[model samples]
Target: MNPLLDERKATVEADHQWIANLEVDERARTGIPLLKVGFNETFGYYISISRAKADQVPANYIRKQTLKNEERYITPELKEREARILTARDDLHKLEYEVFVTLREEVGEQAEAIRHLSRAVAAADVLCGLAELAVYQGYCRPEMVNGRELKIVDGRHPVVEQSLPAGFFVPNSTELGNIEETSPLPDLIILTGPNASGKSCYLRQVGLIQLMAQIGSFVPAKSARLGVCDRIFTRVGAVDDLATGQSTFMVEMNETANILNHATSRSLVLLDEIGRGTATFDGLSIAWAVAEYLAMEIRSRTIFATHYHELNELAGMLPNVANYQVTVKELPDQIIFLHQVQPGGADKSYGIEAGRLAGLPTVVIQRAKQVMGQIEKHSKIAMGLREGL
Candidate 1:
């Protein structure tokens, strides 16, 4: 049996249970009897209106308001019949009240039981979720026969695909070499590309794929060979913690530190735009050090996406590091994302073009272009001076 597919099936079944419990709770709150109540004796009594009437009757009926002045007294035969009927009715009412009370109590107990069951189902779902995510990770497990490498082919991001507008998804593939079984594993992949070129999306795809595999679902990839990972870590966006009195950079660093400390060799780590919350030099230095630590120290499979061009040099220096850039086609006054990953680092980031794409005015676009050119020239001169020094 395919363990990954089995895991996904288990997850769907568990989720169905949770869905059932929700429906049960909603019905219980509204006093709608569950079909399962058919098995109970109280439900049998409630099903028949004749039984309900026999069970309870209002006492001391006047019978007629116009006959109040008349000498309306109970006849001996009528009184005798009334006594017998009232006595039976009172007993039945007591029984019916008991049934109602018991039903209420049972509802509470059933709700609690459903709650406990739902929690168990949710826990199982988490495990299944993990297995499903493994389907996208390209890490191959050793084959049962001769330890052959398995491959993960053309994996798409399931969530991203669903969220994107129709006809916009771009497919990408990841694979491991089978013949060269001893080839070095791809541990650290550095993604460099222009802004809005799908760098973050690609990083997220990797993370999501692993997560889905762990949960035991079919991944968006056409095919996948996944090694079960211990944990998946992501340090993507930065937000200021005003209450904690920490800057955005500080918050980012804190998260990074947590991931670094907790992530194991079997973990999958995704770092996006790391160090961007601080100054260029400081951020670049931190990003470089973090990359080195992940590559040399942890040796975990990682995807690091950033705009720092200097850091891309690590692809040449580090053994397991590889540089991948998102492809973009530049037009006369516009840019389009090819949504494809290619070899080598990106030389330029078209921030102005991105701004224009976001509907910036013509004057602003022209000014941004001029400023960008000046910055590029200054950056080059500064690098040249540093090299000379």
Candidate 2:
């Protein structure tokens, strides 16, 4: 990067040429083809002549060291040349270091200006990308308001839609909080459906749309009018924190407590399978209480996605609660995932069908069916207990 660096490098290389030529010249003078110039840290430079030809060396060659098979010698001229080489190399290195320090200081002086420019360039890059996405993906600009409302018509997940073929990704609508003329939409939606029915995708879509709208970017939707949210809280998957010695259920409870402690009416909360990490009854009770609190107390624009069909009862008890499900088509032998979110709750999760599709053993599937029938027959007691809660 600096011209001085190149100049010093060339000078050092040029100085090394003399040492090589000395080796050739000494070999010719001493009539010993084995005469050579070598350098080491202990002895800077020397000419090595084999012991048999040591007597033939020129008288000007003062002995520096002797070995069993060779004698190391240094002439006055060689010493002078070695000193010059060492001094030139030292000066060159010092000059190169000075050049680097100067360049670094200059960059440090412009650090603030460079950082400001970088931020501006980064922001421009993001806006350019969003603009290109809007043009190609047919995204719409959402209307942003200051109320507790979020409505999206025919919205698709921005990332998921890209993975799917064109016209294949089913678009779903979301309505929350109040719209002017229509009946007041629910503040909290209890999303129930079969496993892998795209419930998580749908929840993410709504959150992404709301975030895109607030950030002045077009949303992946046909139309949207989103209220500005103070925050977006999400608890989507299960993971154990082994480093902290916390089980999956404990980690889930910690995150849930944090959300409940900080979430407000102006926030958007997306929860998935809130209590599946614990026992059935314990999990059900916690899920029910969490849904009820989010709906009645915090009044956050929330989507509670769960396999707990019993949660549907919250819609009848809480005025700001509603039920939604991702529908499926059930055949005699198997089920088809429709991946369509619509009103009303689903009673069955069709998890056994999912296992069957996943290639579970036939005997295992059959035994699971029998076990499920027995569990359902006794589930009335659990249902009654849930109603009491």
Who wins the TM-score comparison? 2
- Over 250-290, each residue of candidate 1 has an lDDT whose tens digit, in order, gives 99999999989988667778999889998888888788889
Off by over 4 Å in 1: 1-97, 100-151, 165-167, 175-182, 380-389
Model 2 lDDT-worst window of ten? 380-389
205-275 in candidate 2: lDDT tens per residue? Answer: 99899888889999999999888999999998889999989999999999999999999999999999999
What are the clashing pairs of model 2? none
What's each prediction's TM-score? 0.63, 0.83
- How well does candidate 2 score on lDDT at residue 203? 90
